[model samples]
Target: MITVKAPGKLYIAGEYAVLEPGHPALVVALDRFITVSITETQDQGTINSRQYLETNFHWRRRGDQMIFDNRDNPYHYILEAIRVVEALALEMGHTLRVFDLDINSQLEDQGGRKYGLGSSAAVTVATVKALIEFYQLPLNRLDIFKLAAIAHFNVQGNGSLGDIAASVFGGWIAFSTFDKDWLRTVLKNNTFSEIIASDWPGLKIELLRVPSELELLIGWTGSPASTSHLVDRITIAKFAQKQQYQNFLESSRRCVETMIKGIKAAEVNVIKDGIRLNRQLIKQLGVFSQVDIETPELAELCQIAEDYGGAAKSSGAGGGDCGIVLTDHSVDQARLISAWNQHQITTLPLTVFELTGANV
Candidate 1:
């Protein structure tokens, strides 16, 4: 059996702005991961994910194509990965043998409650990794990332794919969303295989250096927000008042830029300033866009962190889920968690997931 794993992601800054082309966001991979275990079977192949699907999905081959016995399997990402890798392998004149897949994730509890830690992206990356290994495909981490991005886009029509990039690269990263305009145009002009044939020009991702003195305190609000729903609402709001949103975008870009520089330089003041302004701008965006992005609980969480001398804000879509506190000292990290616990918010025991000698 071969087992592969991919980490979940957290957004440090640049949530909505990163959706646009050419804008950069700070993303970090956390220790939580999705794991995929593949084992050879005799009669038929099975995909079992008790953590998610609660039942095994058996696979059958119809000529060169792989088909599932039950068509309505809940684990769509895993199915997408199989279909993608199978098509690519056939294109390369290589036929694949089947195997049973056992999938699990640390990003969610057995109750199926997500922490908003990019579990979907992690599963996608893990599935892609396991298939690449099984098929013996000559693909690098970046190649797998691209394949996962395409697979996810095929499943869900909208996303910046920042989580996909984070799941691929691991650790601290500066990521730009793929060029939506160019991608849309290419999709119109070329087939999926032909599009994957060339170097993707729409995306840019790189590793960023994080200071050793910094610490992250993640607090969960116990409410899961649907990111796609939040993103869809925000997109509609942006077009409703283009001028106002445009201004918000400009300020957001600058705030993220400053935060990046602050992390690089280990300047707490600069980082704090950026975090404060960024949260305020995001709040204003909610007002201008007429979307209830931030919740009262999240606001109280941020206020608590700020009172403890840490820069805190809602990490992702902001209706609920989790928030982060950036502090220069470990003492602040401990204190923030304690205070948040007092308010009934649980602090996740997570740290940055640095890629250490593993591919995919």
Candidate 2:
């Protein structure tokens, strides 16, 4: 059996700003992961997930293509991932043999409530790794990330692919947007074989040192975020509001830069200031974009964390998902959690996941 596991990610800084080119987003890989297992099979290639009951899917080879019964499978990431790597194999003049695949995720509940921890990206990354192992492809971490991005980008049209990078190469890192326009053009214009063989010229992923004396406190808002819809709305708003949104993005860029430096240097005040400023800037984005970036509960949660002498902010796109608190000590961590509980926000069972291998 070929087994591969990839971690989920949380954005530490640089949210909406990373949508632009040449901007940095700091992301952390969490302990939770989407794991994929594959073994040689003779009859048919089947895909099953322990995380979703409705995701028992199977596929077969039809000439050179993989054919399936259901066209709109819920486990699209795995299917798309399989297709992507299959394209790579086909480009190399080989037919990928059949294998039975099983997927298991720690990122969501069985009832299908996403925790907003980049589950899709993790699934894509894990699937890519599993297929690579199955086929013995000579692909490195960056190759896996880029190929996984193809699968993810095929499914969701827009994203920085920062989450995918984090999952493929676990741990914290400073990431910039891959050339979305370039990738989109290739994905749209090129054949699957050409797309698989094409190089992603503008991809950027850099490693960052994790901060010291800080505890990562994560809390779930008890609701999921529609990141795709929110991203589409923001993209529309960026065009409509041009200069104003550009200013907001610039400010966000500065705040994220500060947070990265502070986290690296163990500068507590700089970290706190960056976190506080990010909250204000995200609110400004909400106003400029006319979208609810932060909910009342999240605002209250950040306030409670601030009151406890820690810094807090929403982790990702921020509609109704998890928020993070960077507290100085155990006392502050406990206080922030207790206070957030009072505000009806429950603390999530997550922490900063350290890498076992190379991060960069």
lDDT of each: 0.81, 0.80
RMSD of 1: 5.8
State TM-scores per candidate: 0.90, 0.89
What is candidate 1's CA lDDT for residue 159?
74
Give lDDT tens digits, candidate 2, residues 233-318: 89999999999898988888888888888878988778877888887888888888999989877777777877888788887888
**Per-residue lDDT of model 1, residues 244-331, tens digit only:** 8888888888888888888788787787778788888889988887777678888989999999888888887788988888887634
lDDT of 2 at 360: 26
What RMSD does each model have against the real structure?
5.8, 5.7
Worst 10 residues of 2 by lDDT: 68-77
Candidate 1 segments exceeding 4 Å error? 54-74, 185-194, 358-360
